[model samples]
Target: MAKIDIRRPHSLSVADARSIVDRVAERMREKFGTDSQWSGDTLTFQRSGVKGAIAVVPGEVHVTAELGMLLSPLKGTIEDEIGRKLDEHFA
Candidate 1:
């Protein structure tokens, strides 16, 4: 599996961060056929093709994504899509 991580510093409160993560996770789940859940500062996702978690701490948000071996050939596309979504959310 290939792991991709994105880190951003934001001024959002814990609750707001959680909400954003939850929303983003849901969107990702629907679009990518993944399972996602949020717990406090962490949002985790698992699917046959990929798995990962997003961790939010204080003023920082970290997104980590792992692509399965079967999907390794599309790693660049996957990473680019994730980066785009993160940019949309943080912007």
Candidate 2:
């Protein structure tokens, strides 16, 4: 498996950050067949070839994921998309 980790600073309140995360989860479900759930301020998600968590805090968001072998080659693309969305929502 390939590992992906990303951390970005943001100015959003925890509530707003969570709203952004909810949108992300919906997008992931539509685009990637992922399922997600929130545990406190963290969102945990998984799909056939991916598993991850996004943690929301007062001034930052952290994301971590593992890509299964068949999907590992697309790690950079996946990470870049996440980065783009992060910037779109939080930057």
The Cα local distance difference test for each model comes to 0.80, 0.94
lDDT, candidate 2, at 18: 94
Residue range with the least summed lDDT across 10 consecutive positions in model 2: 27-36
lDDT tens digits by residue: candidate 2, 1-91: 9999999999989999999899989988998798899999999999898899999999999999999999899999989988998998889
Q: What are the RMSDs of all candidates, in order?
A: 1.5, 0.8
Per-residue error at 86 for model 2, in Å? 0.5
Q: What are the runs in model 2 whose C-alpha is more than 4 Å off?
A: none
The superposed Cα distance between candidate 1 and the true structure at residue 18, in angstroms, equals: 1.4
Over 4 Å off, model 1: none
> What TM-score does each of the candidates earn?
0.85, 0.96
* Model 1: residue 8 alpha-carbon error in angstroms: 1.7
